[model samples]
Target: MDIIVTIFSTIIDQLQKPTLAFLIGGMLLASLGSKLEVPEPVYKFIVMLLLLKVGLGAGISVRDANLTELLVPAAGAAIVGVLIVLLGSRTLARWKGVSKIDGLATAGLFGAVSASTLAAGMAVLDDENIAYEGFIGALYPFMDIAALVTAIVMAKVSVARRASNAEIAADGTMAMNAAPKTEPAQIEGLEKGLVKTILVDTFRSPAISALLIGLAIGIFAAPDSVYDSFYEPLFRGLLSILMLIMGMEAWARLSELRKVAHAYILYGIAAPLVHGMLGFGVGLIAHHLTGFSAGGVVLLSIMAASSSDISGPPTMRGALPEANPSAYVGTSTGLGTPVAILSIPLFMALAAAFIG
Candidate 1:
């Protein structure tokens, strides 16, 4: 009972922070049919600045981090990413009225990291005076790339298998006789440049590119003065606007989500909590092994809970063209992102409760 009270109190306190308050306020405005809307170009610029800030900070930290400290948690993050998608494949993919393609696409998004959400998590932790490793931001690409590549590969394989089965059912004798000749070619074609495509697309995506550029500049050049004087001060104000835009967007996507199967609505609501706990569990193991900090664990949970709002959708659209955008995009932007943001304090509270 005491534990529950502590968790609830932490959540309440965290929600009152400006970063979160702006989010809730935006939702309220949108719900009331307020005409407030941030221009797309301005929103994109805010995201770029935020990602660069995160990357620059992480890069500076990475300059001094021990090799082992970075590698172990990175491996853990990659594993969590793959596990989230696989877990969803078994559950969401099998739900009645949910197509396999749609489910996997949704899973891929959930598994992928959210740049805005990561920034938000960092902001909240900063506000609460929680100390975390700087290299935590560096782990984003490993998890993001792994989850995306895994999901797209799985979806392509599933589609290929279904196609082969269909051919056999249509003409069993011909398909069986030609199976040895045709199957290998089909497999080879699926494997050919599929990963390359996903990789190129992901790296070139606006958010990831901004982050990578920031990381590069931080590592290879001396940006400390500018970073501290310029980016640092601007971070919170920009994040508040970003959160407001996200809140309005989340509310706007609700109608699209409502059009999809009810299972998706449920999944969107529940997956963040479940996936976050999974991440927290992995972070615990890392902490015990490598002394991964309490705040790092909470951030990892935030990454897990967040669904991809920036990169995942376009990558999924290109990779799995047949999948319905309304399902994955709506569920993610509409429900998953909000739940993930709201759950930040819960994970932070859990980390304090357990790690302390």
Candidate 2:
């Protein structure tokens, strides 16, 4: 259809060139071991801008976020994403016979949702005049909940497996504080190494902080412009830091990805495609039931694959070095990363034109 082609063209314009540039730039920087780093505050600043943008965009669309009507499709997408993360990650981990830690890591990693990527999607959708609601921002928080839950579940599974195998010996028992060891079933209650790190990072990261802040602002203020004067410099700085950091992060990953190129290709590409299709279907059905737009549907699907590029897999790797972390992490990112960029523009155009 003409609409599809046009949407593809727009996505191509945004993605094809940008992704290539990202790869090339990442390669050069990574190869050179370029010290080009995003300062801590700068990273925070960028997140603030993105969060503000997401909040403003989402806030303006609140009128469209009717629970009585819109909940069906939104819930559908969530269900699909949950199934995909739960079943998909478990399937891959089991078939691969990856280490228990690796399996759990993959589950937690895959379950998480990425707000930045979704923000990019929102940007693309806006250009296309799509009619998606701002509550879309909630996807990030929702995914975090999933990631948190999955993390606990996976950790418990790993603990159980290790216990059965007698891997968590006397020495290991001492290392984990001996308290939770008396009963490994307390995964949900006691914090472990990986989950602890994730929780710390989740709160410590300014980006997450800013998103929560933005949500609060949106809730309190009518037109977001009312508080615009406060975070002026922070917002302006966010865009540049985000762009440059994106390149830097891509480069960093590309360096490590060389070893497991094949796996990355499969996981990254496959994960998003599966999620995207689910999202599209959810959007379509939502529309049929409550007249949600096609654009909204597409955006929902694209968002399913969102998660931290550096955090999830690295957390897995650090937590369980024995699982050949590269296979799961590299493959997931390699395929997901580039496609993620394109998904933003493509889904935005789809959701905006039809749903907006």
Best by TM-score: 1
- Each prediction's TM-score against the native? 0.98, 0.72
Tens digit per residue, CA lDDT, model 1, 308-334: 999899999989999999999999999
Clashes per candidate, residues 3 or more apart or on different chains:
0, 17
> Candidate 2 — which residues are off by over 4 angstroms?
1-10, 16-35, 165-207, 227-237, 258-265, 310-335, 345-356
Residue-wise C-alpha lDDT for candidate 2, range 18-101, written one tens digit per residue: 433454465467568888776877565566667766665555455456775546754765565466567655565565434445
Tell me how far the alpha carbon of residue 180 in candidate 1 is from the true structure, in angstroms, after superposition: 4.2
**Residue 32, candidate 2: C-alpha displacement in angstroms:** 7.4
